[model samples]
Target: MNALTPQPSHLAMVPFVSVANMLKIVNRIGPAQMIAGIAAYLEDDFRRWEQFDKTPRIPAHSRDGVIELMPTSDGEIYGFKYVNGHPANMARGYQTVTAFGVLSRVENGYPVLLTEMTVLTALRTAATSALAAKHLAPQGATTMAMIGNGAQCEFQALAFQKVLGIDTVRLYDLDPAATAKAVRNLAGSGLTVVACASAEEAITGAQIITTCTADKQNATVLTDNMVGAGVHINGIGGDCPGKTELHRDILLRSDIFVEYAPQTRIEGEIQALDPDHPVTELWKVITGQAEGRRDARQITLFDSVGFAIEDFSALRYLRNQLSDPGEYIELDLLADPDDPRDLFGMVQRARP
Candidate 1:
């Protein structure tokens, strides 16, 4: 069907990059470098924002957890991830989440990379959070209060410390063990970590308040009274229709910011606000089309729903970084029959 000289092969070769390879790649590049590279690509994509085929995230919700699919492409490369968030997974000796993703070319529909996305998601989520905070948080913000101490807590803390000039993190969670784990992970990073007993204690005098709790309901992790002026709230966990972290009154009082208006309208903290309520897109701030932090008294909230373009940027970055010899394992997703029209003969030859 291609009408070319050499017929296509039945075995289409694609590469599979494993978790260890990814770890090596990420470690060599470092989180700061990766975040910077991803930010540059995100800005470039935002400049040509009209070229992308964007769609809302697809989510499947159950009583215990939710699974989501986020896909996006720019007519050249297509990427999608299958990730599940089950808070109870840890109770059963499994991680609270697991994920995998595929990056494919659009022309011939050949997969270029298939990698585990569980760790990758943690990386990207933190990168996105820091990216937004960099644009929205007050200049020279050094202290942060991380309200959730789950698996993502350490990544978020490091991203902010490395990218946003944050030097101290006040950590708190319902589970003291989780907070202890986060503190231990951050050891030797030259950053101070304070494990507070309550959310109120953690948030006190912090420059940025990051709410990343895993509850899948409309829970108020950040209340109106706890939030003060000039605080940049990075809301990462409330990313579903029924899930939220900030109280509705806080959203009404703060200057809300989001990734994509349409998608965030349903999934972000904006879901609690009226449809007509005004909010700014993070891309606008990145492009210098809109103002971020104008005054010390104005509270800014980044209602992050983890947009597809971020993943696209990340996969693009990962693919570029792993361009050395034999960084991935090749696979055959399609079978080639040597002759385009001799499919029946090939099947007959394989009858044995």
Candidate 2:
């Protein structure tokens, strides 16, 4: 190499986990175990939640979908995810959500890892819900009512099973095909799976109700009359402005928990309530700074809006797993010049 041109080295490459590699990693670790690992990272970070730089995701809304960038930093490392939500995409044979993420060194502002996040987001979202339920749900709760059987349904089912010892899942969706898909996917997963005709039927005898429908409107997937006392609700789907899954009356009666108050108020089911509505911070509960469930009869709701720190935690977990060479490829993403000032010379040398 010339004095002005440095040879490529590990420092000049970024670890990239493609969708295929992600699948291989999931298969190697197993989905439920991978989710549990992510949950462990999430819990550790949330316990020290005060250390993170948190902000509401930046979103650009369109008639068809919304694209968002969720970013956060824990002083030493920075992470962000690029995600899009397009409910209509499923009708055209595409996923409703897709995402990719980057984890970087804060000191040098250089990317350390890049990975597909569409599957990782689902895993972390489910893990976060299960972690919240571990704190807020009634102790020894075994059954969950999964009220939407979309891409997130099976992940939610497995997370609850792995994290909270949930043994049964009752599934319901507006589309019978979606419910059927969940039934097919969860077959022989060691949990009793029941496909129900309606949301009401799904909630029958269930202690945890998880609503994850993908709609861009204020849709009441769960009504106050339908939810009984002593149940924990995981509100997962209504995660943007003008979107919600629970009735306002249910919010008025439940002890609501949220990730970050400012962002959840704008993007969660709590958006239906007053801006200053009383809600518990989940990190406080995890850290024992606040109480979770006061009584079995008290209904608890986790208004999950999918925060950036959760994505950061997920990226951190994925980056840690990159020690397995089979799970990733190195990308020639950065330029390394022997002379720091010879950027043009470095470019000219590549013209061969």
Candidate 3:
């Protein structure tokens, strides 16, 4: 260890993993607490939302499905996720969607955490739902109707329970097997789960309705007649351009809210509404700049398109739980030059 010997000046890198490890990390904190924590973080970010560089998510739509890139930063930390939604992939032993995300520091433009986001997406979507419900749902929303009993169903149920104190859930899906799977996954959770024969049967007397179906078209999961006063509908599945859950009449019947209006207008349930139709953004309600749930009888809808800020909040939550246990892969993407003018020499020397 001579004084003249120069040690590596860069920080260590982080390795990404599959959804298996992610499920354990999120479970360790408990989904409800995680959602509550994430909601607070979201509030803080929304207070300064104007500081971030917001962009419309980038989407590559094909005949089969759509893939999207959502990137955002508060001029300090940058994060992005590579997620593909292919409904046909379920039969191929793969999820209909697959995802991974990177968290990077803006100071040196280096990634701090590279991890799987499929599980994180599920967790964050639920958190986002509860976050919106915190502001939009009527007082004492104890019952929730969960539509689409797929991979996301369990997380949404737990999040609403943890974040909004929901104790009862009614489940409905086109496939009875899917609903059975959801009930089995949620075994011993103390949530009163009722399997319903139809979407109308599930949403009958629920305070909150969550739609997470995987259909790639504009399917009407909820119509105007099915909606009740003071119910907060958390629409999840219809996230892409051509996909939607709630009918146009349902949106027209409720005070629809969204994460980012400019982006949601093109992707959220608001896509079916008139261009000039009025709606409130979630951040505004969170910051108290706008009113939420004006009365107990006002119908509300949180048309969730799943914004990047929620992912930013989720990444930050994961970063806090990690202690950098020396678990990462180091890639040499940048070269250290002995002298400022020796850049080319450094590259040539680094070549095999």
Candidate 4:
């Protein structure tokens, strides 16, 4: 609290994790270990998935991009994220995607933690991908092909390395500089990084294939002849309608796994398929109710569209990590009065 500003009751204050503090949290824990830690939290949440409310994200679409609100609750606590995806922003010297989120108590409708999620989203997205692969990827998978080396490329490589024992990453992007940037970032991460010219070359000898292009149209980053049997495809780029990365034929060949079937049917790679297409919910697989990786020759696809439960788990992990003393600041977010019904008086008292 600033000394010059009028101090409100404790109930009016909320812990706010700024971008700098978020970076502190990530660096203090180490990226790979933090990704693994978040993956563990995700597993715990997924086990009790039915305990929380679930729904598709509410999105406002436009010609340039889309903005979305993702909300969920676990009876005791509620969390929501406000995020936007503007692929054109990259060319305009801005982030293609940015986000912020809040976690609040259910007993009283007050925010407990508010934090920037642009960085956290990248981490949680990678963690979710790694967590799903842990259940669905081919056993003993050593190499991964990361197509579209954008903001998420290095994080995915590090997460797979820490969580799934992947040692080699082959990267390819429409722009050579993007691949170079990812290669430079992953140099000292104890992984053999290879920059490939084509997606076909990137997938050679790679047990896992990750597509994360940032186009807002139906672009086939991977075709039927390109993807073979026994490879786990992590579809990360297809988070909105008409913005898909994999071809329809691949979805037909692969055993699709998704966070929420309803959301995936609308926003994920499965959008190209019929409404009744069969897909295994990732929670069911994590809870051991459904099968993953049925056979070595069977193709597995995690059609991830960044669900609300995953973000909720990420906020839970961040709150836990900040339980100890840290540099996070507090903001006077709520208007608290001595009498619950005297909200107007609270404002009047601040007129000095």
Q: Rank the candidates by TM-score, best first.
A: 4, 2, 1, 3
Mind giving the per-residue lDDT tens digits that candidate 1 earns over 1-352?
3444344353566667788777777787876677667777776776666688889988898888888898999999999988887877888988778888888889977778888777777888888888888888988888999998998898898889888988999999999999999999899877899999999999988989999998778999988999988898999988888889988988988888888899999988889888989999887888788888888888999999888888888787777777764567666655667675887876665653
- TM-score of every model? 0.92, 0.97, 0.91, 0.98
Q: Pick the winner on TM-score between candidates 1 and 2.
A: 2
Name the regions of candidate 3 deviating beyond 4 angstroms: 1-12, 15-18, 324-352
Model 2 alpha-carbon miss at residue 100, Å: 0.4
Better of 1 and 4 by lDDT: 4
Residue range 1-352, candidate 3, lDDT tens digits: 5555443445533545446666666677776677677777777877787888888889998998889998999999999888899988897788898888888999988787788888878878888888889889988989999999999999899888888898999999999999999899888887999999999999978999999999888998888888888888899998888899988888888988888888999988888878879999888888788988999888898988888888888888777767544433444344457775987876665554
lDDT of 3: 0.83
- Compare candidates 1 and 3 on lDDT and give the better one: 1
lDDT of each: 0.84, 0.94, 0.83, 0.94
Q: What are the root-mean-square deviations of the candidates from the true structure over C-alphas?
A: 3.9, 1.8, 3.1, 1.5
Clashes of 3: 0
**Position 295, candidate 1: lDDT:** 87
Residues 1-352 of candidate 4 have per-residue lDDT tens digits of: 4565557889999999999999999999999888899999999999999999998999998888989999999999999999999999998999999999999999888999999999999999999999999999999999999999999999999999999999999999989999999999999999999999999999999999999999999999999999988999999999889899998999999999999999999999999999999999999999999999989999999999999999999999999899644748889888889898988887786675
Residue by residue across 1-352, what tens digits does model 2's lDDT show? 5665546767789999999999998888899999999999999999999999999999999999999999999999999999999989998998889999999999999999999999999999999999999999999999999998999999999999999999999999999999999999999899999999999999999999999999889999999899999999999988999989999999999999999999999999888888999999999999999999999999999999899999999999988887788789999898877676988988888664
* Model 2 weakest 10-residue run by lDDT: 1-10
Overall local distance difference test of candidate 2 = 0.94
Model 3 weakest lDDT span, ten residues long: 324-333
In model 4, which regions exceed 4 Å deviation? 1-6, 324-326
* Poorest 10 consecutive residues by lDDT, candidate 4: 1-10
Off by over 4 Å in 1: 1-11, 341-344, 348-352
